[model samples]
Target: MAAAQNTPGQHRGMDWCGFAGFRASKAPMQAYAAELGATMQLQVQMPRRQPAPADIVEEYTYTRHFVAIDDPVRLLEILPGLPADKNHTYEIILKDKPCKLCVDFDGTDGLPACFASKQDFTSRVQDVLTDIFLTEFGVQLPAESFVWVFTDYPVKFRAHLVEHHIMPDGRILCLPQHNPTHATRRRQALLQQAGAGHA
Candidate 1:
């Protein structure tokens, strides 16, 4: 059952709709690293306000190479699944030597899983991205670094910041604006497809 309702902004932990959040500074990641030793790096940039709000907010990119794993498809199937409201997009390149996976995620239909505002979320995500690249790929993120990764063919995560300007009327517009008709059709299609498949 969908549990009892609570605050609108408060997400239920088990619902699978929240964010991965700051994985470091906690156990598991910390615990795993204790045994793994210094394999990664994490860096951050101080926030700077623009004379006028700009579309470009945050960006990250990383690349690494791994021993030709026996099966790359299996490796990809295991990465955490993205929420329906959100979508993760990337390219998997397999060449003669090693294999590489490049992936990134945008804010999607809702606000980021962490931070109070989009700006805060952008900064935090950038920090996490740098940390992952440093630790996973053994690379360092430089300020104005532009790019945080450079490795053989393995796995890479990258992101960019795009924005929608707020009108002088004090209205902010974002993607995935609610459309009741669209929602209803999507739900009905799901039901019909389920029924047809079952038959």
Candidate 2:
């Protein structure tokens, strides 16, 4: 049997939004960090019941990603009392201009875990970052450069269509008709055709 697809509300009361599939130039990180000094920070929390083994500790440094922890202070208090052989989790915080973004490694590689209260999950941090780079640092990125995905479990993503498509005959087609309404119509037509074929 096929596994159930993950969607929002599957986990009951938890929804996450973040960006993926966007590649930014290395210049942004360098420029931001130069201006802000340590634009990113690594937060490590040692295990509670037992200390992390040497290999796990080494892995933390190598992977450069950490599990999300609620209270770092509480974890620190227990850290001093536990043995030195348990595993710890890690979290990376990126200090983007005007917003402190938390990077969650699960579901997608380095998805910024921005809650819906501030904005919908469809919002892309990459767009904001791209704007900052262009306005502040004079760096320009292509349109629709960031893809945002929001979900409750497993994981699914939605991205904008590229500006142009290349045909098999080597013809290049500009995609001005790539809006949501066109996509919905295309999907409905495909479904209707499939249903008729099945009949």
Candidate 3:
């Protein structure tokens, strides 16, 4: 998954670089860090959780690693090889600036209990990447600026910008344009109303 060489006008003026993955593994993280000529450090946090058994409480812990790169260009060069998993979380922050990019994979199709069926996972990821770019760099790039080069996942292109709608009060609204279930429910309601009007 080595990143392709940057062509003219491609990702120009971009000082930030990061990758998104669904449940990506640690091996890939280390690999990416090595490629970027950086060191990786792992941090583990333990939290307690209480379930139906009120008397019993359980503690769980998760580990996260931090990789700092001096040059973002090095990070950008290895974008294609980054892990793309839904179960794990990964991020890299620039040491010089307050710029960072993170990928959230909790609700994606990777979690079967949460997502029984595969939704438009790639499009959602693209929207999130776009939003992050906007937030970090304050630049709005065309949807095509981001591309999913992994062949393991279904090929997807951006249908519309779901997270780009910014309200006047400074709140962001994510209105998915191609939600099948929402569209179905709305269609059903419309048909019912039309039937009632005729009766």
Candidate 4:
């Protein structure tokens, strides 16, 4: 599920991240939370485990896009940590519209693991997703569709849309704008003109 994140110049707090609750008290989980807490500092929140009944356990409440990650390295990289066998879930933000994409790659050889390099992983995944969306959803995209696309997954940091190329979000930007060849555009225009003639 996606939650509203704190935009720049906005209030910096759990309230801003729309962060909910979960508990992780194990040594690794605790260490991960500590590191994240220290790293995020004032930009985000990492509260300690709240009081609860002994029988009733809780999970660590994460204030980020992705969730249920055990590795600090992967989490910090804004990647998921699931077995290669399992399908990974990603939130694709196309033209400012978010959609869930669950995909399972065939054959593990050279296949991307869940928690790989944040930017590289996202770039590669989005490339394939663009094809899928464009073909399945149709050539006419939403009004908000832009030449470039991105996601809200927080890597070393969270990347965002802004003027001057793009604001740094810790992940290196590698996504190229969708530029159709001139011939392709001409053919599309001809097709439109022909259809209009029929109408």
The top-ranked prediction according to lDDT is 3
Model 2: lDDT equals: 0.32
Q: Candidates ranked by lDDT, best first? A: 3, 4, 2, 1
TM-score each candidate: 0.22, 0.19, 0.23, 0.22
- Evaluated with TM-score, which candidate comes out highest? 3
Better of 3 and 4 by TM-score: 3
Worst 10 residues of 4 by lDDT: 154-163
Which lDDT tens digits does candidate 3 get at residues 59-134?
1112233344556565555444434441223343343333222222221222223222334444444555556557
Off by over 4 Å in 3: 1-92, 107-109, 112-119, 125-140, 147-199
lDDT: worst 10-residue window of model 2 = 59-68
Candidate 3 has an lDDT of 0.36
How would you encode candidate 4's per-residue C-alpha lDDT over 94-193 as one tens digit per residue?
Answer: 4323222222222113322442544554354344444544686543223233223232221212222211112235432222332335324533332233
lDDT value, residue 65 of candidate 3 = 34
TM-score (C-alpha) between model 1 and the true structure? 0.22
Error of 1 at 12 (Å): 52
lDDT of each: 0.32, 0.32, 0.36, 0.32
After superposition, which runs of candidate 4 have C-alpha atoms over 4 Å from their true positions?
1-44, 47-116, 139-199
- Where is model 1 poorest over a 10-residue stretch in terms of lDDT? 59-68
**By TM-score: ranked, best first:** 3, 1, 4, 2
Residues 1-199, candidate 2: write the lDDT tens digits.
1122212221112221111112222233344435545433222223234443554332222111111224556456544543354333333322322211122112232223433321332243344544554697564545454323332222322222222223356654323323444445543343233231110
